[model samples]
Target: MSANPLLAADCQDGCFFVDGRFVPADTTRDVTEPATGQRLGRCAIAGAEAMRSAIAGASAAQAAWAATPPRERAAVLLRAAQALQSHFDEGALAIARETGGIVPKGQHEMREAVVICQIAAGLPLQAQGQVLPSTPGRLSLATRVPHGVVGVISPFNFPLILGIRAVAPALALGNAVVLKPDPRTPVSGGTIMAEAFARAGLPAGLLQVLPGDAEAGEALVTDPRVPMIAFTGSPAVGRRIGELAGRHLKKVSLELGGANNLVVLDDADPDAAASAIAFGAWFHQGQICMASNRVLVHEAIAGAIRERLVGKATHLPVGDGASGQVALGPMIDARQLQRFDQIVKDTVEQGARLEAGGTHEGLCYKPTVLSGVKPGMRAFDEEPFGPLVNLVTFRSDEEAVTLANQSQGGLAAAVIGRDVARALAIGRRLNAGMVHINDQTVNDECTNPFGGPGLGGNGSAVGGPADIDEYTRWQWVTVKDAPPAFPF
Candidate 1:
């Protein structure tokens, strides 16, 4: 496979934003394109002083931003969305180059980023206070308030959309934001977001972007000035952030890992189920949190589904992300590729039978399917953030639901069955936050609550009007008709 042209470009140096100014970091790190191990760009690494400066900037600008009317705040968000759309092509190219997302997925993510900003722009209106009926002349009310300064730690996968999704809501709610972009893809995601916010006329120092690795993340999470932290990444890091936030009595929203599953019953349309599962499992090389890593089918139809899956997996186009036909791209970096390879090896060693492509070229791992996988294998129990699927068979509806719920993580799950009653029952029983009936577990419309339970780690789902509430706090107020008869 030829290397993506965007990934092969020379390093472009950049800086961190502090107090509405672009300040150079004390150090720099070289970012590489994982697909071919080529240098893409250099990102400034923020240190302790830079971290403090960002927090101060966020704190300084938050009050004035918060004082702005909700409608005005929302208008800013809408403007940011427009700005993002206006620069879509440039943003897409940067995302594709830095994150190794094939051009199409990169473009799609950049568009979603713009949409997220637009959605967040409506938050000021959505954050309206509730009026409760009071006795006689008294009135009771509740209103949402900003959490002062917020810290956002984004992941490498879906960098553009996910990072902006968190930051936009926070800003729309009138809170100042300090964002730590994923080091691997910071050059594209962080710079683009900052520029969009600036173009929308957001106040200087209201939104800041700092780029670096784990230490910078730790600093942001533990800073005393930051009242809340929103993070999206691995379970290990999520747990650490939780611990630190807990100690500081800070608010946190952790969107973490997942080992999602798709259940296809014998009564369902085999063709549709097979196609949906294939797309969910192989999209972005299965790096997504909601991707179907496990496929549970009824014994009667498992054979047909397995065969179809194998054929589809074998033929998926693998090449430079720029190729329009390509469906699977390389893992974000060599480390992810190594971890995926080890998981496949361990699954095979534990008795799972490999049924399709397992070839590796550079950071690209062929879309693979493994059969005969049981609860004993790690692949069955853990989330494998790669394009590998484990197939398991169930004899009955009860057994299928039990098998699907066996994993500790429960981000999302799906059920495919002809009987609506049966599918609804199974969907109800599934422990995941989002359950898809008769379809793959992919997000749509952005109108529903989407997050996870247990070790999946996210505190709140990221869709619908509820997401606006997540970034803000509520306060109840009551106005007494008089100073009270009993003046004691």
Candidate 2:
């Protein structure tokens, strides 16, 4: 109700961008400032009718937009990128206020979103079909076709990047999108996106932003017009979407839960390892799916690594992201705070040592580091999705690799050692889809493929050229110019 320190955009009307205009739904939902539990504003909550309209709009626009050539489609995305760049400060502030994410990280996510747009713009250069040798007088071609209307269900954490990451590529591949951003961060995650695309002269009804909760997501998933779904959220919800998509026989792409780790060998620089791992674990309050929640440090340098990590954690200024003094901000909401509390408590009760932190002041959680953690413990096995890391020691390189791969997680894994060759070798033994040699685990870029096997994702990487594969389906065609001579 009061003026927010980080407030940027005013959403007094509770409007959603649908059919090329800002329209209000009959019902509205409150968007809260997570750091203080303050009601920032009311946002439109879409009902079944609104969702059906959005789906129809996307379906109606798909054929024309698909026929509009990749160069023009890419031009629209490039224009959107520029427009979004001009609104960087406002959009970043919106993200900070909604998710308690630091403004700097918000800035990074927006800029990354811009880069993804630029990358998707280049998709036009990538030829989509291949001519295959066929029987006499018969010509065959295999082509990648757009999946028609794409349903994007994005998450609250890193909303801007996650939502736009899929949307840009889907649009580039000539498919219209229906985006449902988490209700908590609708403005940053969804609203600004529509503004940019509209400014870019994209066709009306090509992009729709509906901000709501589970009901809206269900509507999007069940809509038969949407032939594909791209989702970034919890594994539980992702599995449900997978099931629903399966029944409909629709394509699905998911960036789901992760149980990642950073392995530090005795030969590595302790300071470097500590710094990288701490940043990986605490940046964005460890809400990242790729956060290095499990730390496998050699027992020889365990004490030194522990001290450095602890020192770094305790010194970080924790407060509101808008304050500009805070290194890390608060959890998303009270439920997240409770989740971390129970995880830390259960971890400590199960024999892991709480080396530092494990305290909270209201919404702000102090960065936490746990030492002496072992297998079969929640902290070591599960993804806490909070500002915490469970530290465990290993004796040999063989054991370290074994422990890192034991989680059955396939998203990301890192090996930190001075010997580049050795780390590379050890990294090869890890089972994650993305491996970092002498670096942190929480690494991703628009130029790289980011997805995994097992529970991490649906094996469909969302960046680089992989986006083309995820957003399209293959079709084979055969044409005969004349009658073929049959070999009898």
Query: Candidate 2, residues 21-132: lDDT per residue as tens digits?
Result: 8886788888888777789887889877788889999999999998997789889989989877877777787788888999998888888988998998888659898999
Rate residue 42 of model 1 by lDDT. Answer: 74
Whole-model alpha-carbon lDDT for candidate 1: 0.82
Model 1: clashing residue pairs? 102-321, 254-458
lDDT of 1 by residue, 1-488 (tens): 12222222232355776666566666988888866677876788887778887888789889998999888989889988887777777678677767777888888887888788888877778636889887877789987888899999988888887788788888988899999988888766687787777778898999989987778888888899998998888888998999999999998888886768799989988889889988888888888888897899899998999999999988888766755557777889878888888888899999999999777898888999999989979888888888887899999999988898887767888999999898989889988888888888766555666678876775477666667667888888999868767857
Among these predicted structures, which one has the highest lDDT? 2
Worst 10 residues of 2 by lDDT: 1-10
Q: Residue pairs in steric clash, candidate 2?
A: none
Residue runs of model 1 more than 4 Å from their true location after superposition: 1-12, 133-137, 480-488
The alpha-carbon root-mean-square deviation between model 2 and the true structure, to one decimal in Å, is 2.9
Quote each prediction's TM-score.
0.94, 0.95
Task: Report how far residue 85 has shifted in candidate 2, in Å.
Answer: 1.5
Angstrom error of the Cα, residue 414, model 1: value is 0.5
